[model samples]
Structures are given as C-alpha cells and as structure tokens.
Target chain A: MTVIDVRNLRKEYGPHVAVDDVSFSVEHGEIFGILGPNGAGKTTTVECVEGLRRADAGTLEVLGLDPHADGKRLRRRIGIQLQESQIPERLKVWEALDLHSSFYDTPTDWGRLLDDWGLAAKRDTPFAKLSGGQKQRLFIMLALVGSPELVVLDELTTGLDPQARRDTWELIERVRAGGVTVLLVTHFMEEAERLCDRVMVIDAGRVVAVDSPSGLISRAVPEQRVRFRPSAPLDERLLTGLPEVTRVSMTGTRVEVSGNGDLLHAVTSVLARHRIVAADLRVDQPSLDDAFVALTASRPHGSGGSPGASEGASDHRRG
Target chain B: MTALTKYELKLFLRDPAATLIVLVLPVGIVALFGVVMSPGGGDAIETFFPSAAIALGLGQLGMNLLPSTMAGYREKGILRRMAGTPVHPAALLGAQLVVGALFALVSMALVVAVGVVAFGFGPPGSIPAFLLTFVLGVMSLFAVGLLVASIAPSGRVATGIGVAVFFVSIVFGGVFMPVESLPAFIADVGDFTPLGAFMRALRASWAGAWPEPLHLGVMAVVALGFSLLSAKMFRWE
Candidate 1:
C-alpha cells in the first residue's frame, strides 16, 4: 500500500521558494530517503508531510488522509522527529517518554523502546543532563512510542559522533524490521546509500533523480577505473579488446584500465591468462557520494532552471 | 488531558525558583505586612490590608507567572512537539492555564491562612460571593497574561512585559495604597482596571455583601475580551 503521496508540492518563505514542484510517494514498509544539500528544501518537504507546515500549492496525503485538513487523524498514525526539537530541560527521560505515550490510543511499551534505542540507563536523567547521543535516543524513543505506522525522521544524526551515528543507523534498521515505513531526510550520502531502499536526490527545490544507490551511481557516473602494477610487461591491446573495457593505458610498469561494466573482472581475467601477475590491484568504482556531489553541483541552463536539475529529466531508474 | 496536566504539575514543582515565586511569596508578604503594619497595640488587621494581600498574589500570578511559563514552553518548541501528536497543541496551553490556576489557588489560600493565623482576621462574610468574585478576578488577570504570552517573541521579552504590567497593575489598583487615598480621577480609572475591580469586590464580600455590579461587570468584560484576543493571537511557534 502507498503510505505517502505528494504531488506538485510547493512552499515559499516570503520571496524565497523552498519546495517547488516536488513529488514523490512511499510504499508501505519501505525505508525511503530524501537526500539533499543544506537549504535544498528537504526538511520543508518532510515538514509538510508531518503536517507541521501547510503547502502553498499542490496536494499531500499520508496514509490516504490529507496531512493538513485531517491532521488529527493523520497524527495518530505517523510519528515525527523534528530536526532541532527539544523537551523541557528539567523533564526526565522516562517522563518525556511517558508524556508522549499518553497522546496515543495504543502506545508501544516505552520501556522496551528505551532498551531498543540503548537508552535504558538514562531513563531518570534530566534532558539537560543527557549527552547529545542520549538526547537523540530519547527523541527516537518518543517518536516510536505511538507505535506509528509511518515515522518521519529529519536529520536524526546530524551532530552525533561516528560511533553514535552507526548505532542510530542500526536502530533505524530495527525500526524498519518491525514493519514501520520510514521517511528519512538527510544530507549524508553514505547513510542514504546504506539504509534507504530508494532515495530521491533533491537540490535547490528540485529532484535530480530517484533510484537505488547502485542505480544512481552507475547511471550518473559512467566510468570506473582499475589500477595495478604488472610483474611482466604486457601489450595494452590484450586488456582493451574486451567488450566491457573502454580504454587501456600504461606508464612504465603501472597499468590503468577504464570502463563501464565488469571492467575489474575482465581485466583480472586478462591478466591471469597472460600470467602477468597484477600487483597492488585496486578497483575504483564510483560511489553514491560522487553522484550526489555531481548532481547537486551541476546547474541547468536557460531561465528558471534548478541548480540541481539533471542533464535529462525523468531519470528515475527504480530498483 | 489528565496525564498532560500531571506532567505539567510535576515539571512546575521541579523548578524551585518558580515555586518560590508562585506559592511561597504570597504567604511571606502577608506575614511581613501584618508585622510591619500593625506593630503597635491595635485592633486586629483590618479588611483592607488582607484584601490587598489577595490582590498582590493574584496580580503576581496573572502578570508574572503565566506569561513566562507559556512563552518558555513555546520558545523551546514544546508546543510544536505537542502539535504533531493526536492531542492538540491547545492541550499544552490548557495545561499551562491549569498550572497557573493551581498556583493562584495556593497563593490565595496562603494569603488567607496568614491573615487568619498571624493577624486574627476572619473568613470572608459571604463564602459564595467571595469565591465567585475571586474566580472572576483571577480569570481576568490570567487572560491578560495569556495576551502577553501570545505576542512576546521570547521568554525574556515576555517576562519583561509581565514585570511592566505587574507594576502598572499594583500602582494603579491601590495595592501600595488605598484607592481613596488617590485623586478622584485616578481612583475612577483604577476602578476599571482588573486588580482594582478585584480588590473592591473582594473587600465588599469580606464584609458579607454582594460586590457592586460595576466591579463584577468590569471583571467579566476584561476576562471575556482578553481571553478571546489572546486565543486569536496565540501561535505554536
């Protein structure tokens, strides 16, 4: 079932347009991600989905209900973790969880949620006394206390250390394992690549592409480079003759082969046949990070073009 | 709603400074004034000073306590957090009003207790009349505080506005001096103000009579008008 559907969403702040002509949908039980640079309208789009902001134009529906007009009904089924939200400084962790639970008709067991989020020991700690990671865990626990069908997490790991961020990623995976649909908004490309089932790359109020991590990488980045030093001198045509190999070059004992598909495998097979003993072999496949930078850094031409508009529209290769 | 109110009360109790300002200061004021004003061998404390004590407590709560609490919650995004839940953000606002009203109740009780114990003062002559006037008076003052909370951009600004309103109400409403001591025109203007109307009506009820309709009417209008205006202006920012 489709959990969220947004069409032609548009929102502006005075003269600054935040979200313009944005459209996307999330299926049930999918970890969908919205990835973008700062000021790319990612938060604004998710805020509209959370019913915190009214869209200036277009339609938004969550669980088949209007997020704005049916906010009361929508809220019961969707949990939201805002980017910079906070509880009272003196409120204890358990009190925050208990208070948030009271808002739902059938809340999850908050004690179990605390354990799942690695916040069991901090239950009695006041909000002000907790570290940044503990506070984030508390926020996540509160977001799940409702046993919501859909959880919207915006910038959940912005300031956490690397270890804390990895822990949060695992917690999110557990949340998804429990059959909750996740809508994650973030700028961290690796997080999106690892966690999102499908990501929509947004930049400057426009979507550049919507695809799986590998699909995005392979499509936006057309070439991969393989580098190695050969034990014996070899003819360059022996590597370039393969169908997957695009080009081959050699500088003294070092060889570099660039291609689009199965280039590393074909090159290794060629080296084995020739008994060349490729040493210090390395394959440099393009990553989602590279694709994100390329997508957000490039600009479209003509009047009213988005800064992140892809070279071609309709580049949605869903996997 | 009950759970929200319970947590709100807990948080309020946890803040010592707020507790002292809201619950303890009224009792202190009543005792200090009793000792200072009646040092010599004199009759029991008169009705005026006790009534003034009540006004002081109510004004402190309405102008100082409620605004800072409401604005602080909004400034910290507590209201916005509640806005995303099945419960409406209005629940938080209602909870704040409940907490403020609870403080007002304690302050009033302490003021009366100090009057009875330290100064040999008796209960108000008509119980129902006193309770009615007191409720209306508190409602008006809290409504004015709600208006301040709605407009102030930050908690500090709200507190500043609250202090400013606190001084104006005390100075003009005869908390420092009896209205009769002021010029006739100033006293007439004071009669329309919330604290002035509340003090007058409460004193009349202390003497065992229904308050003047003008005082009750003024309280009613201020209560209704400010409540509506504040509700209109309030934002979940």
Candidate 2:
C-alpha cells in the first residue's frame, strides 16, 4: 500500500522557490530516503508531507488522508521527528515520552519504549544532560510512543559521530521491522546506501533521480574499473580490443582497464590467453557517493530557479 | 492537556531562580517593608508597601518570566514540534498561560497572607473588588508579555525587552514610591498604564474605597486591547 502520495508539490519562500513540482510516493514497510545538498528541497518536501508547512500548489496524501485538510487526524497516524527541535531542558527522559504519549488517543507503553530504546537508565536524566546519541534515541522513542503507522525522521543523525550514526541506522531498521514505514531525510550517501530501500535525490528544488541505491549508482556511472599488475610486460592493445573494455591506461607497473559490461571477465580472459600472470588485481565498483556527485553535478545548468541558476553559473565559471 | 500542564508546572518548579523571583520575592518584600514601615498605624500611604509587593510579583511573572519562557519554547522549536503532533500547539500556549496565572495567584496570596498575619497589615476592605482588579491586572500584564513573546526573535531578546518594560512599569506604577509623591505628570501617565492602574485600584481596595473610574477603565482597556493584539501577532514557530 502507498503510505504517502505527493504530486506536484511546490513551496516558495518569498521569491525563492524551495520545492518545485517535486513528486514521490512512499510504500508501506519501506525505508524511503530524501537525499539532497544543503539548500536542496528535501526538508521542505518532507515538511509538506508532515503538514508542518503548507504547499503553494500540490496534493499530499499520507495514509489516504489529505495532509492539510485532515491535519489533526493525519498527525495521529503519522509520527514525526523534526530537525533542530528540542524538548524543554529541564524535562526528564521519561517525562517527554510520557507526555507525548498522552497526545494520542491510543499510545504505546512508554515504559516499554524506555527499555526498547536503551534509555531506561537515563529515564530520570534531564534533556540537556543527555548525550547526543541518547537525545536522538529519546526523540525516536517519542516519535513511536504514539503508535504511529508511519514515522518521518528529518536529519536524524546529522551531528552524530560515526558509531552513533551506525547505531541509529540499526534502530531505524528495527523500526521498519516493527511494521512501520519510515521516511528518512539525510545528506549522507552511505546512510542512504545502507538503509534506504529507495532514494529520491533532489537538488535545487527539483527531483534529480529516484531509484534504489545500487540502481542509482549504475544509472549515473555505468562503468567499472579493473586494475592489475602483470608479472610480465603487457601490450595495451589486447585490452583495448575487447568488446567490454572502453579504455585502457597504464600507471607505473599497473594496467588499468575501464569498461561497462563483463569488464573484469574480458580483461582477465585476455591476460590469460597471453600467459601473463595478472597479480594484485583490484576491481573498483562505483559507489553511491560517486553516483550522487555525478548526478547532481551534471544537471543541466541555468534551470531558471535562483539556487539552481546561481550554483550552475558558479560551476560553469569553475569549469 | 492535563499531562502537558502538569509537565509545564514541573518545569517551572524545576527552575529554582524563577520560583524564587515569582513566589518568594514578593513575600520577602512585603515582610521587610511591613516591619520597617509599621503599616499597622492605619495610614493610607502604608497600603503602598503590600500593594506594591503584589504588583511586583505579578509584573515579574506576567512580564519578565512568562515572555522569556514562551519565546524560549519558540526558539527551541518546541512549539513547532508540538504542531507536528496530534494536539494543536495552542494547547501548549494554553498550558503556559494557565501555569503563569496559577503562579500569579499563589504569589498574590502569599504576599497578602504574610502581610496580614505576620506584620499586622490590614486586610483588603472589599474582597470582590480586590479580586476583580487582580484578575484584570494579570490579564493585562500577561497580554503584554504575550505581545513581547510574539514579536521577539529569540528568548534572550524577549527577556531583555520584558525586563526593560518591567522596570519602567514598576517605576511609574507607584511601586518605587506612592503615586502622590511622584511628579504630577508622571502620576497621571502612570494611571493610564496597565501596572499603574492595577496598583492604584489595589491600593484603593485595600483602603476600603472604590477605585477611580479611570483606573478601572484603563485596566479593562489594556486587557482587551493587548490580548487582541497579541492573538493577532502570535507566531507558532
């Protein structure tokens, strides 16, 4: 079932259009990620989905209800953890969860949530006294206390350390395992690659691409690179002649072969025919990080929007 | 809503500095002046001490503390977070206003009790009139506080503006000295201000006489006007 359906979502701040005709839908029990750069429209898009901001022109439906018209009812069924939001400083851990639980008609057991989120020991600690990871855990727990069918987490681990971020990723997976759909907004390529079932890359108020992590990498950069040092000196023409091989180059003793389909098999087969032992071989598959850069960087310049136009102009100058 | 209000009250009590200023300070002021001025002599000017004490507590609460707290919530995105939940963010605002009013009432009662029992200060001549004036005073003063919270960009700015308005109100409201001793123009100006009108009416009720029509009119007008203006200007985030 489609959990959230947004079509032609557009939002503007004064003269700046923050989201421009963006559209996507999140399926049930899937981790959908909104990936973008700093001023991209990722947060604005999700904020519209959460009913925190009104769209200038669009139809947004979460769990089959209009976000703007049925806001109160929609809120009860969807949990949200907003970026840069905080509880009262003096409020204790359990108190925040307990209080938020009261906001819904049917709430999950907060005590169980305390234990589940690994916050039982810090239950009495005030919000200001909790560590960064602990605070994030508390926020996630608060979002779940209402027994929501879907949860939207915006930049949930933006400032967290590497280990803390990995831990949070696990927690998110657990949330999905509990039969809830997750909408994650993040800028971290590895985060999207690891947890998102599908990612929607947005840049400068426009949708760049929406695909699975590996699919995005393949779509953006179709080539694979294989590097090996042969025991004996090799002629480069043999590799260049293969159908799978696109380009061949030499760096010191290593022969680097770049191609698209069956690249490794073609290169290794050619080396085998020559009785040349291929030693210290390395196959480099393109990562989501590379795909993200290629996709966002190669966007058509001067899209007319202020942010995109300015960024495009600067890139043009730099080039 | 009850859970939210309960937690808000807990947070308020947890701040020792706020509790000290809002609750204890007024009682201490009333006690100190009652001993020194010997208000039991039944002179009308003696009423200034206790009435001023009550005004001080209410002004600090409705002006200095309430604005800072509400603005801080907005600055911290607490209001925005609440807006994302099933409950309206206005529930939090209602909780805050209810908590502030509770503190005001308790502080006023403390001042009156300590003044009458421990220091032999006279009771209010007309309880109903005194109650009416107190209610209006709280509404008007808190309305000003809401306005401050509505306009200030952050908590620190709200606190700065609240404190500045607070000092000016206390000075012209006869808290520093009886209105009779102030320059004629200053006293006349004070009668039109919310805190000043509140103080004047409070003193008159304490001395067993009805307050002037102008004083009541000023308080009523300030209450209604400021409340309407604040409601129109309030921002959820």
State which candidate has the highest lDDT: 2
lDDT of 1 by residue, A1-319 (tens): 9999999899988878888778999999999999987787898899899888999999998999999999888999989898777888999999899999999999999988888777888889999999888888888888899999999999999999999899889989999999999999988888999999999998667778888888888777878999999989888889878998888888888899999888888889988988889899999978889888766654433232333354544322111
Look at candidate 1 and give me any clashing residue pairs: none
- Candidate 1, residues B94-190: lDDT per residue as tens digits? 9978987888887788888777777666678898988999899999999989999999987899999999988888777877687767778777888
TM-score (C-alpha) between model 2 and the true structure: 0.96
- The TM-score measured for candidate 1 stands at 0.90
Cα lDDT tens digits, model 2, A119-206, are 8999999999999999999999989999999999999999999999999999999999999999999999999999999999887787
Fraction of native Cα contacts reproduced by each candidate:
0.76, 0.92
Least well predicted 10-residue stretch by lDDT in candidate 2 chain B: B37-46
Q: Give the interface-residue alpha carbon RMSD of model 1.
A: 0.9
For candidate 1, the per-residue lDDT at B56 reads 81
Model 2 chain A — which ten-residue stretch has the worst lDDT?
A: A310-319
Clashes of each: 0, 0
